[model samples]
Target: MQDAIYAPHWNRNAHSVICVLRGRAQVQVVDDFGQTVFDDELQQEQILTVPQNFAVVKRASNEGFEWVDFKTNDRAQISPLAGRTSALRAIPADVLANAFQLRQEDVSELKVNMERQGNTLLRPSRSSSQWRAIA
Candidate 1:
């Protein structure tokens, strides 16, 4: 596991089994309707199965975490909900702005931030605080 939270994402072609090897983790999986499907803390030697295409996020405990993930497909395509790999970036700015109910300028600013961060496994520091708030 990584120290930073792995932002919600899904693998189009794979299901995954994660075995905790060290420390602990908080795992959450959600359905298409954004309903929580699973939420729990996993400690060393525990395992969790993530069904194919289910949106999931994993956050390491304060002591940090490590896990071995086995995926059904060797070549899984991950679509992130935030950050550089987010599928939202592929949408037209005007369409995205309308869908998100945000001003075009705000959408542009979001795009700029996304581009600047590049592909990161973890959400940025600013967003991480929001996660903590929810936790």
Candidate 2:
């Protein structure tokens, strides 16, 4: 796979185990306290566990990456924190603006930028230099 991000998301109903089958990947998982619980690069044959309800994001390296995902449930649902399907869109704009400590117009712009991406699996872009910086 090309350099891509799975996006920050959580599976409320199931835990998951991911095994890296090829290339390399960077994985980060945040706990309920909003602290990063795990952040590391994974190599071929490496495995990582993602507990249910924790938010996680995975980025494949520029060389590309592949992995097998195993979930506790036969059907798992994901709630993305950022993307067109993000839960943030469901919140009232005023509330979101207040929570983000931004002007309503700024919040609207943020929403627009997020929606413009339109993809849950994000491709690397010049604007996403920060994510690309991860080694």
| Highest TM-score model number | 2
* Every candidate's CA RMSD: 4.8, 4.4
C-alpha lDDT score of every prediction, in listed order? 0.77, 0.81
Query: How high is each candidate's TM-score?
Result: 0.73, 0.76
Which candidate number maximizes lDDT? 2
Tell me how many residue pairs clash in candidate 1: 1
- Model 1, span 18-134: residue lDDT tens: 898999888999877778999999899998888888898888887888888899998977778877768776788999889989899988877776776654356335555432211
Kindly provide the TM-score of model 2 when superposed on the true structure, using C-alpha atoms: 0.76
Q: How well does candidate 1 score on lDDT at residue 63?
A: 82
Instruction: Give the least accurate 10-residue stretch of model 2, judged by summed lDDT.
Output: 126-135
Candidate 1, which segments miss by more than 4 Å at Cα?
A: 1-3, 90-110, 123-135
